[model samples]
Target: MEQHVQKQPDSPVPFFLWRHLNTVRRLVLLLVFCLLILLPYISLYQNFVAGHAYDLLTPHERRIYDVMEWLTAPIARSDPANNLNMIKGNTWSGTLFGLKLSDPLAVVGQVAAQFKLYWPFLLTALLPVGLTLLLGRFYCGWICPATLLYEINDAVRHRLVRLGILAQGRRMDLRLKYGVLAVGVGLSTALGTVVFSAIYPPLIVGREIQYWVTANGVGAGTTFFLLTLLFDLLVARRGFCRYLCPGGALYALLGRYRLVRIQRLVNRCNDCTLCDKVCPFALRPMRDAFGQECNNCTACMAVCPPRALTFRLRIQDQPDQGPGHQGPAHRRAAVRVTAKGEVA
Candidate 1:
């Protein structure tokens, strides 16, 4: 069977800077994630964690009862209210849903304690809220450690499938996210814990490295690198993102309500289907762009030959009129008018 491919467009896009910066930022974040995983054992960043934790919690969570009693200084006289101002006993089972997970390492090793020390709880709390408003789940697309892991895993799976070691499926079977969504919601509502956080890639990698570093040394760091490499180099699609992330599932719901989207002008479309092929999320960009599943990746816009498709920031929903709805006669008449204007 013969296949047709569209030629590249002549002019460049202005948003290439935005796209390039996004790509570079993601790459750097991925590297930081790697370093964070290794730092527990190498003790490069662990001291920072320890110093922060000790400075903040020394009088409360960690100081011995006698030491606390013996200290005559006014600073040593810790008020229960001061120690607990951050956490209210009125624990709503569901207020902070999808915000954070309860990982053993985060909870047990006192690193979680340190995280709160380095950054104010309110500041961290505001990130998802503010980001959700401006960029609409930008954290999920770029910074979330879990998404990065999934992207790497998916890339590996793609190569393996190409090599015939794995079979490819047309349907993404994305219903898995719904299941994870349910479990996360249920656990958070019922148990007052973000159950999904235990398996969340960030916490998983963080905790695993913490344990490994405490037990092994540089060898453990090597193991962590190899595991990350295997996931990225072997998995075809964003396996973890597609199959496991509850946070992603939550943000997808937010995307449904998000106003901004990558829209295609159907009248100008040349039927090249470049957008459909380049979409990483496996969304049919032409048919189902505004259907809440598309991640606004803009791969279609990057490849569009005539710049036919544009990222329209629309205020109202437009009807899904099918492709090239007008007849050839109407198009020819329009083209003649356009040609006459050009000649004049």
Candidate 2:
């Protein structure tokens, strides 16, 4: 949406920047998911090449082998097996040009379970941790593969609400996820295993996509992920990410003092409340109350007609900015003060 707040002198929002961030975030989400899907086929092709199994393959398998070979022709012209291995692994942990990168939650989980830090693994998470510290739980919004599915599922929830098949949204304490995170860590420590990979939606999505695509049969997390979809559809809106995700809890904590945060340009706000309505996490962007729970998803900014929302460099959210200047409520209050010399 085009912003009309370009004339506001004190507006913090730069009319030129981040206006389309929501769209860019959506594209990045899809790209990450597409890579997850594509990687499995690449793995299969690498295996096929290693085994020299083209003649032994059935018709369907041969077709997959052929398609993958064609896709990787430029990259793997000389050494299909070695070259195609360059971009391996999923979002949980991956390598590109020998630079390993991983989710900070994964590093935390592994260390907690083993009670020892693998320096190599720990190093892999630095980039993500540093980024989260600066961006505030942006991984949930920008990179998580499961977030892509969760949002699409959220769209379905909206349709169901419109059809009266489901109620609007069920509210709960946002602190619930912190408890889940503590419990998850406790269990991992006690069990001496990284248990979150089984329950966390992002890792589960990556695992299941690799499994199902490679014909390894559906992983057990498939049922659990499906149940989460059901829960989001029937019980609460975006329930898993909103309340139960341990990874989200970890990210939120790490990003609690994040430097970049979305805020309302109160002067430009008309209190349309569209920002509040569109937030997946049920945050009230118009009220200037985005806390640690915000992922900087930019969905609020996209729906705002007056373009009252924008990212700002701040460690904490602004306190309630009250009614928007352009809104009728503020106008009525101004009228009352003008007539009676006191706020009504």
Candidate 3:
């Protein structure tokens, strides 16, 4: 809660790999997105393998069976059911290598819906909650399939803005997501359903990917997701995630005092505003204003030409550090100070 430095501290050199984390993060996002698409097909294959019904299947079914058989031949040939059971479900709630992990918001939404606790189900979310406590909304940055699409949408937004097809994305109050979370919780309580699973972009994206992959006609979620893309394109850049996601609100609350956060290195910063420009969460890393909303996506760090940003083990962001030492304002100030000294 109390974060301040009376004077700028000397720099601690960041490791070379710190900047590469965004690339690693993109790879992780793609891997997770692929897994979301792959797991459904795997489940479909598992059903056929478990039934031993290859001969009974239709031509299309047999082709799926053939491809899945070849794909899973290495590890799951013996017992696709048991062997492939190592991974199941989507990001909302999934078992991986015998460990079940779930979205924290999933648990919250369920509790609101059922009005009773299922301890076994609740336990599944602990790993993610624990990670969020330390990592501060890392799920949004590193794992959420929706985020990958949102960023692509953001890129498209930039293009459209340049072409005068759209204006710069409108900035709304960040607190709006908290209101969304409250309303969603209330609605779940009243409706007795985990309503967020339908609206939450990550869950929606995974569900849609599965449908399209499994050759099930895409669901209503596709239409909703497409609207979100348009919302980001026309209304705001990442409008839903920034202003309306309940899951994001929950993570922001949980990770309010996240132990590991990105800190600005005043010495290296040139106040060029690149970090501010690239931040997905719209955090002001250039002004040391990274708050709970920062997902530690490191797009800011990656875009830092001076390599000014780095991660630190701290509970809060440093107070504003003023203009970077390399900036024009600081240079002008320095010149004025030197002249005053000579005059004195």
Runs of candidate 1 exceeding 4 Å displacement: 1-14, 18-22, 25-35, 38-123, 170-176, 189-192, 214-239, 315-318, 324-344
TM-score of each: 0.57, 0.92, 0.92
lDDT of candidates 1 onward, in order: 0.49, 0.87, 0.87
How far does residue 243 in candidate 3 sit from its true spot (Å)? 0.4
Expressed as tens digits, the lDDT of each residue in 1-344 for candidate 2 is 22222224266555655778899999999999998988989998898999999999999989999998888899999788899877778888998778899988788889889998789999999999999999988999999999999999999889989999889778887789999988988999999998888998988898898888786778789999999998888878998898999989999999999999998888889889998999999988877988998999998888888778877899999999898887878766666565664433
Q: What's the distance in Å from true for residue 84, model 3? A: 1.6
In candidate 3, position 76 carries an lDDT of: 94
Off by over 4 Å in 2: 1-13, 334-344
What does candidate 3's lDDT look like per residue over 7-62, in tens digits? 24367668789889999999999999888877888898999888988889999889
Ranking of models by lDDT: 2, 3, 1
Alpha carbon RMSD to native, model 1: 11.7
Residue 3, candidate 2: how far off, in angstroms? 25
Residue range with the least summed lDDT across 10 consecutive positions in model 2: 1-10
Ranked by lDDT, the better of candidates 1 and 2 is 2
